[model samples]
Target: MSVTIETPNAPLADAQAMNEVASSIGLDWVGMEGIALPIEIAGRPVSATVNAGIDLLAIENGQKGIHMSRLYQALDELTQSELTPALIKSTLTQFIISHQGQASCAHLHFSGDILLSRPSLLSEMRGWKAYPFEIDARLDHQWMLTLKIGVPYSSTCPSSAALSVQVAQQQFSLDFDHQPDAISVQQVSDWFDKRGLPATPHSQRSWAWVTVTLGQDAAQFPVTELINRIETALSTPVQTAVKRSDEQAFAIANGQNLMFCEDAARRLYRALNNQCHFDQVAIRVEHQESLHAHNAVALAVWKRGSHAA
Candidate 1:
């Protein structure tokens, strides 16, 4: 087979040629783009399906481009092997050393949708869906190695629930008090009287991003474990399946344990703080309101195994 390729930059192998240009000029990060390759994520695995976004930056100044071909080859190697935080740390180390560590840090962001299989309630049907996820790996002399993972979830506000209940009751009482038609209103009033104006706490689409400092020679994290913690803390996990029973069950669950975005963020922050492996972590939640036009948000951070002060 033969090939003809044209481009604005030269091949990556000519490191010597690129270095001569870069050494003289002060530059930060440099590398390739859209270099597709399969990656074995921690929670999900698919062959030739994982695409990793690859880049390599030179620590030196005036560097035009790192060897794009070498970066592509590195990605190829990453696919055949395991794609873990530890592997990513090692990958960044290679990137730094390749360019003589001229810049102090190197990073790679790998993003892909992970397919999840969920069992339906009552129906026993198996439903599958994809969630957006990403792994951020970076290497620095001071920071050593840091890996961050992001997962999307949902949050509900407890205050909203109390308000809804109040509104439902007051309106019911005013419209139907002491009248023949008042019976239906009475029932509504009773329900609202028990519940408030915002009878249900607002639930919002949210995400949790966790950062970890890798131990010696470690590449990947316990992604499965991290995911478990997220689901557990949120309690009222949103679903991709919406059968009649599922909807009812979800409503019941949310109504029972109504939470605010702040609550959700605190829950996750505390959960990660208790974990021993992570040296630091950050949790954030965003609540999209059905009752209002603006979204509510909450955030928490943990450092050195303690909640950030």
Candidate 2:
């Protein structure tokens, strides 16, 4: 006896479509975060941590769930292209299109370090420096793009420098008060060699967290330009490679640009506000105090035509 077996071809079931909650509530944002993706930054490929999502506004259809796979695939397609304002806008538009009527707004956030080769202050050698940066883009009624970066620099406390100068003056008075009318240059030189300023000002490594709202006309990310502008404004960026001359130059820069956190913030605010590409700018400066365990921080914000804080 011959036995006949028949196989049934059936479509796979989609749990997201079949299992819907009874409630008619809508969620603000629904999607994935911490998605690892490789992206091109500053014409170089870099590893980035990405967060992509969309607003769940389709409450009428019971809002089963968003198509997460589509979002992931859309982000994966970006690996071939360099990150730019236009690319980000198009990607977000694709996100909305992929969801059909399920989402009306989309958001994309990614963070990575942009490696830049920096020359020493006085040496001919150059070394790589990684600047941590983030890009946040949102599309709803209008497109909004914000760029943020962290820049490390040296901050010599102004108050501490003043106190050091005062101590040095007192010590000088004590050493030269009873000297002869015609004091020899060798004696003064020996005194300076013996006691180097009597007291030294305290300085610490500081960070400048800068965020800027890009204008709609911006085409490029301007990561390097922004970093350069910030470093110029602060005037004391941390060095990457250094020789003795470079170290001396760095020390001189720190001494010349004595600032508190507030001073640093103000410097960035003024510099960024002058740039026409930035519509809104926010600056946060933190001086990790060498004298104290706590950090000194200053925050400032500036709109295009509004007063800065």
Candidate 3:
């Protein structure tokens, strides 16, 4: 009681291949963004968001669109190995090869948070800290790689500390004015215990954004090394596992290493400039002030041959 008609065998339609373009204008970049992927960083696997693209130069020849699926497939296949300069170069090469004559340049960007076990300042305890980092790669005339990282630290305002000290001195003078002859080390200690300081300097959590242009000879991303170097130079890296002793040590470190945003920028500039791996470096430091509505910031840049080592 039922009859069915057979369908004809025909090639599927491809609009990207068959459609005519409205204009022959070329695009600087064309591809995918916010692709979820797993990438190895610092000898561990972490989830990353990636963006892949290539220049659509063949549009001048009336090419309507690029094969975006090819870019996705290439990223899915090539990112299995540990991320390194060699791997990035290979990925970019695959992008160009997949598009053949349609693309001459390729770009890749990926970002992830890396977890590192950090020891307590003055204790045997340790805890984890996550560092957010980004890697950008491009291949045109030659390969170029850039590494960027955000580092959190404590910034104590030098001016505020000085003012705090002056207020403390004035308070001490007023308290011991009537008993000048009775002033002794023990009496002074007792007075400090009873009255404490009238004022305390303000400190706030701060950040340093470090960007570096890696030389072609760079084998791997130096994320941990760069973080350590910056933390050491600034000397007030935010703590993770903190005992009372560790907290006191951190407070002492902040007191001894008071700096403004400009000082932090200069310290990072000098620290990174001494390294031979980077051809250029840029630094931006931000102090999230507790006293003001606006944040304090400083910027600095260094080139390879422009400065003497």
Candidate 1 lDDT over residue span 1-309, tens digit each: 987667648755644344454455544456554545666766467433322222334345445555545555666557666676556666766766665644556667666666778665456666775655555565676435455555666555667667776776676666567667436656775755764454345666666666655555554656666666787777666677678988777777677666777777777777777766676676666677776888777777777845563
lDDT of 2 by residue, 185-219 (tens): 99889989999888899999999999999999999
* Model 3 deviation from the true structure expressed as Cα RMSD, one decimal place: 2.5
* Candidate 3 lDDT trough over 10 residues, lowest sum: 15-24
The candidate 1 region of ten consecutive residues with least summed lDDT is 47-56
Over 4 Å off, model 2: 1-8, 61-63
Question: 42, model 1: CA deviation in Å?
Answer: 2.4
TM-score ranking, high to low: 3, 2, 1
Please, what is the whole-model Cα lDDT of each candidate in the order they appear?
0.62, 0.89, 0.89
TM-score for each of the candidates: 0.74, 0.94, 0.94
lDDT by residue (tens digit), candidate 3, 4-23: 64665767666666544652
